[model samples]
Target: MPIVEELIKEGRIERPGIGVTIVEVTDEMIETYGFPKGVAIYQIMPNGAADKAGLLPRDIIVAVGEKRVETIDELKEEINKYKVGDIVKFTVWRDEKEFVVPIKLQQLGG
Candidate 1:
């Protein structure tokens, strides 16, 4: 894949990331919290991309661009499709409403 090629050429692969700890929203969680299926932001690193973009804990990420992601892996996969510093629009669900947040991805720490 492109990641392998990049690593081979550059000796390292810089992955795009929004600094946040996330948890997958299971069916049980959705039923208990009355939330839709998605990955919930459990924590945000201070001054990181997510924090800078005003993303907060408990925000549910429902989509990356036009791709709907219902699990942590899907979110990660979607995020990896972009380069660091690329501004990607994420569909977030918060307080029972859905909105888009533009986040500039930063390089993830090794």
Candidate 2:
């Protein structure tokens, strides 16, 4: 099983279905993505909210709403500030292009 599944089963984390594992973007990653450091998407769950919003693996999330995020913790903290069903804009960098995508947050089990 996925680590995320294990975490969910252990009640150590909530399953929000944003469905993406992220890491802090490093200097190398920033150079590769042609963007400043941010939260780098490592994976995107199939058919999940992030996937539906056009977020893909390797996309660097630079901002959530109007707040800039430089680390995974910052990104998660920003995300937690909003409730499920709230639509928020995410600024992402992919393939040397920057764009904004709106995502409607969802809870996995409620």
TM-scores for all candidates: the values are 0.93, 0.78
Q: Write the per-residue lDDT of candidate 2 for residues 1-110, one digit (tens) a residue.
A: 46588587776654343778888988886576566789888988788789899898889899999999999888888888776688889999888787999998877543
Score candidate 2 by lDDT. 0.81
Q: List the residue pairs that clash in candidate 1.
A: none
Q: Model 1, range 1-110, lDDT digits (tens) per residue?
A: 58689889999989999999899998998889998999999999999999999999999999999999998899999998899999999999999999999999999962
lDDT for 83 (candidate 2): 66
Weakest 10 consecutive residues, lDDT, candidate 2? 10-19
